[model samples]
Target: MTTTLECRGVTAGYLKERPCVRDVDLTLAAGEITCLLGPNGAGKTTLLETLAGLLPHTGGAIEVEGAPVRSGRPRDAVRAGMVLVPDDRALFRQLSTKQNLLLAVPERSRRSSALKQVLQYFPALEKRLSVDAGRLSGGEQQMLAIGRAILQRPSVLLIDELSMGLAPVIVTEILEVLRRLATAEGTSVLLVEQHVHLALGSADRAAVLVHGRIADRDSAAALRADPGRVERAYLGTDAA
Candidate 1:
């Protein structure tokens, strides 16, 4: 499989002296989803940010499509075909849903086509185009966030905590959309999710992180079939 994004020996955190994610090595392949699963405070978000160039890594390197990605430069990451959908969904609350999505693809000639495609993935947003993003329901807001990311045409999509505050059905629907993106569009995804089983069900592979380190790596089918291995990794007792 073709590698889309990769990080090697990366250590990142808010403080240079105190890294939250340490010496992480991960790879994402084209047309596949890799789930990063761990207990809270496992530095999943920190690792994703570092990979996206949102946070600078104190050590090691990140690459996209074989090109080195400059640390702490979000624009470089985006230009390298990487997009991040942060845990908070980070929308412009004052802007209408349409306005928010239109901002993603700034070229006038491409905006119409991009918007049409986004709406195809998220038809619920078509009727809510005039509504302010802040006024939309939680599920609708999440849909809008993912839709905006789709407009960027990213080859590698880094999503953090996709199921946060949403109903199970909404999460399932969104996961299906991710599956379609991987199968139909060949979008590579690295997802940090709290819903372990749901995420495992959708992902091609999974890495379990514990206390800022990768404790286990396996195919999702293998991990799902052996939940105790994942549990041991989460509890930081896999080696024992």
Candidate 2:
């Protein structure tokens, strides 16, 4: 199977001398959901940020659709069919929901297609089109962030923290849409999630990160059944 996204020996951090993500390699196949599971401060975001070209990398490369990606070119990533839906809410507070989406378009001519697809996944956005994005609730902001990324029609989508401080019902609603993209539309997803069970439920395969490196990579079903492995890693014990 051909991979939609890959990280090859990527090393990056805030300071060039100190690398938070060290020599990491990961591959996500087209049309599949691969979950990255790890404790907070385990360098998950660093790896995702480096791959997204948000942080400057001292070495190695990120491949999206088989093309090498360099730092400081978020647009290049978007153009190459890789989009990152960041953890932070990206809505423009002053803009109405409809205007916020129009702002997502790089060119005015692109507005129609972008708005059509984005609103397809998020019908609530259509209902609240005239309202300011900031006035909407937290769940709505998250939906906007994800919808904006998908508006680019990316082949690979990297989502950081899919379930962070949201209600269980909201998280479930979000995951359902993600599943459709991976299965129906053939869009691959790389999800970083704190909710282990939710990640397992949504992903076909999963990798657990420990101390900035991949500790385990296997079928999600297998991982879920092996409580000892997950528990040991989470509790600071070596894998039993």
Candidate 3:
């Protein structure tokens, strides 16, 4: 498998004195989904932000497709074929869906093609193009967020929380789309999610984080099948 994203001894947080994620090591392969699972305050979001260059890493390094990408250079990461879709699902409330999609891709000529490609992943957005993004339901907004990132066609897509605040059915649909993206487009997805079962069910592999450290790492199916292990790791009773 082609390694798309790599982290070695990564430590980062809001304050230098208090790193939330410590000595974390992770590898994401192209055409695979790797779900980062943990409870609240497990430093999942901090790690995601650090990888995206939103927060400076206090130590260690990050590499995308073998090239070094330092902390605090988010655009460089984007230019290097990486995109971060935060949990907030940031979108222009007043802008139409079509406009938002168009804006995501810089090339004016390719905007149409990008829109079409993203709409294929999210066909529900086809008829809602003219509607204001803010007016869309929670699920539609999440779809739009993912679609916009898809338009970037990043080699590595970092999503903070894909299933947050969405209905179960909608979450399932979105997870299916992510699986297709990994299988068909070879996109390396690193997602931070709290929904343990759903994320493990959809991902190729799973990494459990607890108290700023990786507690367990295994194939998603293995982790799902061994719920007791997952429980121990999540609860910090067994940081294997």
Candidate 4:
């Protein structure tokens, strides 16, 4: 099967001399949801950022649909059909929700299509279109951020910490949308999440990152079936 995204021995960090993530090899298949789980400082964000072309990779390569993606070139990544939705939401706080989402489609002719698609997934946004993004609830802001990303029609979506600072109900709602996108739209997703069980529950596969490397990779069902193993991987005891 062709992979939507592939990272081969990718190494990157904030400092050029000191790499945070090293020799990470990961892949996301089409229409699959891959959950990345790890504790704080595990370099999960570094890996995602590197994959998204926001950070330079000092070694190895990243490929989207069998083509090389230039490291540190975010626009090139977007052109390659990859999009990253960071934990910050990256919404224009002062702008109304409609204006914020409309920005996703630069061409005025495509703005309606973009808005329609986003609203299809997040109907709640239609009523709140006139409201400022900052004034919306946390979940609503997240929905808008994700809706904006989806408007880009990316082949691979890298979502960083979708569950951060949101209620479980809201998280569930977002996860459900992701599941549908993966299944119905054939959009591959790489999700970094703190809620291990919730992520593992919705994901097709899960990878545990420890000390900037993948400690274990397995089917989500298998991981859920043997959570003690996942715990060991999370605690960095698997290698001991």
What ordering of candidates by lDDT runs from best to worst? 1, 4, 3, 2
For residues 1-240, what per-residue lDDT tens digits would candidate 1 score against the true structure?
999988899889999989999898999899999999999999999998888888998998999999999999999999999999999999999999999999998899998899889888889889999999999999999999999999899999999999999999999999999999888889999999998999999999999988888999989999999888898888888533
Q: At residue 25, what lDDT does model 4 achieve?
A: 94
- Per-residue lDDT over 131-223 for candidate 2, one digit per residue giving the tens place of the 0 to 100 score: 898998878888888887777778998899977778989988888888887887788899999999878887888888767777777877888
Q: List lDDT for all candidates, in order.
A: 0.92, 0.81, 0.91, 0.92
Give the C-alpha lDDT of model 1: 0.92
Per-residue lDDT over 1-240 for candidate 3, one digit per residue giving the tens place of the 0 to 100 score? 999999999999998999999999999999999999989999999988888888899899999999999688888888888899999988999999998888888888898789889988999999999999999999999999989999888999999988888999999999999999999999999988888888988999999999999999999999999889999998889645
> Comparing candidate 2 with candidate 4, which one achieves the higher lDDT?
4
- TM-score of each candidate structure, all chains considered together: 0.98, 0.92, 0.98, 0.97
Q: Write the per-residue lDDT of candidate 4 for residues 47-104, one digit (tens) a residue.
A: 9898888999999999999999998999999999999999898999999999999888
> So what's the TM-score on candidate 3?
0.98
Q: Candidates 3 and 4: which is better by TM-score?
A: 3
Angstrom error of the Cα, residue 1, model 3: value is 0.6
Q: Candidate 3: count the clashes.
A: 0
Deviating ranges (above 4 Å) for candidate 3: none
Model 1 segments more than 4 A misplaced: none
